[model samples]
Target: MSVDNFCETISDQINTGILVVSLDFTIVKWNRFLQVHANVTPEKVLGKCIFDVFPELPKKWFERKLSSVIQLGTQSFCSWEQRHHLFELPHTRPITTDSHFMAQNCTFLPITSDNVITHICILIEDATDVCHYQTMLNKTLESLAMANRIDGLTQIFNRKHWEECLAKEFSRARRYNHGLALIMFDLDHFKLLNDTYGHLGGDKVLVETSKTIQSLLRLCDQFGRYGGEEFAIVLPETDLVGAADVAERIRAAIEGTDINFQDQIIRTSVSVGVSIINSQDKRYEDLIQNADNALYKAKSSGRNRVCLSTELP
Candidate 1:
């Protein structure tokens, strides 16, 4: 076949909108892709001003963009990311897409005559599928980031995120010289409980305990799973006395509630250690260490009780 015929064949078969416009902005050529999708034949659009044909287009911005391409004799391009579409043409997949019309990537190429620019060939490509995949990927990334912040089993803050919160609370309390407290608690005889009822029973007890503690906490409290059968809470604006009261309340609540697992009744208790920020406390870890020390005292003396850091020494 001849070169001109082959080029025409390629342009006709390719599935993208193509149009050529003269210096006066008159539509000179329209490809089959545009003919089918835009539902306007070449006979009607040819020799007609583009602005007259499509009145909804942003005339000023388009004129400026086209002027630059003509003067510089270089190609120009625009994506759907900037503005949605160059034409108000109806897209083919209306049933599936949420979009009202087609999203487009428009390219303006200078068509030269005898080494001088004369007309511009505009190519319009549908970016609907690309936009769809990008949106899905963004949602997936958001879900992953959220999962990182929460524990998979209990749905509370995970160790890393909870520690981050603790550090921030510590800074705020120290800066403002306000009150703050930390509570570290362990389920008493957890190993024995697990052995008696299997890991599944222990899991249920942990899940239920987390829910119960959450229900009792104020909005300022931050809870997290420290490790297996162990948990921690950061109570903002809480003093030593108030911290002790909070610890005791959590202890009694857990002791009172009966957890049912595998159609069998099970019971568990927590040994809690409470500590408040003091003038001598150098860092956030110091507060956690003090609470841990009190927890050891609670466990050593007896399980199912609360211990205060101030009473330790």
Candidate 2:
């Protein structure tokens, strides 16, 4: 077979679309793949301006790319990620969802004769399956990460994740010498509620209390289930007074909220302790310990009250 026949055979047999355009953007060579996918014949498109044939094409963008290849003697590439499709080809994959056009990655190569650039060849590769797989993988990874960080019952940050956030916030506050606060709170007489209403009723109280406290806190504040019925909160850039105010608000909210369980309304209250980071604090745990101690004092003095570590003698 002749060289021309070999070239024609390769162009027709390849899966990718190939189109050759002159410097004036006139279609010079339209391969079979392009003819079938674009629903245009070579006889009709040859010697015609490509933009006129496909008016939806990004003319200015393609012109710049073509000019670069012609002037700089280099190639250009466009991925499916950057641009979905160069041509509105029919979707052939029936199993894929939310896809209408064939995703494509395109390449532009300069076609030179005797070192004088004459035409540019555009090659298009189908990338639908690859793009779909990548999107699905990303969503799966995101769901997995969320599951690991969130508490199963409370729908809030778990103890381990909350501790990680506290450590980071503590370091940031200490490094910048900014104010930070910790609040530890738990239900008063939680065992009594559990015995009276069973574990399911106790769970209802925990869930409702978590939601109430979360609604009262700021977006920057971190609230998490430390363990069992106990919870902890991290307040960045907040001083002792601000932290105490937050604790009081949460305590009031919980006391006011009535959790419904099995046709009965159960009321509960929380004891809160607030502690601010001080110059003498060595680690994040030191702040937690102070808050815990203050919480103990609140429970001893009276339930449903907020206490500050600084106020303790």
On lDDT, the candidate that comes out on top is: 1
Highest TM-score model number: 2
Model 2 per-residue lDDT at 96: 73
Per-prediction tally of clashes: 0, 0
Q: What lDDT does candidate 1 reach at residue 177?
A: 98
In model 2, what are the clashing residue pairs, if there are any? none
Cα TM-score per model: 0.70, 0.91
lDDT of 2 at 261: 95
lDDT tens digits, residue span 1-313, model 1: 9999998999988978889999999999999999988888899999999999889989999899999999998999999878778898787778777788788899999999999889999999998777667767888999999899999999999999999999999999999999999999999999999999999999999999999999989988999999998999999999888889989999999999999898899999999999999999989999999999999999999889999999533
Residue-level lDDT of model 2, residues 1-313, one tens digit each, is: 9999998999998989898899999988888888887788899999999899888789899899899999999999999998988777765685774778888999999999999999999998888888888889989999999999999999999999999999999999999999999999999999999999999999999999999889888998999999899999999999988899899999989888888899999999999999999998999999999999999999999889998999633
Least well predicted 10-residue stretch by lDDT in candidate 2: 89-98
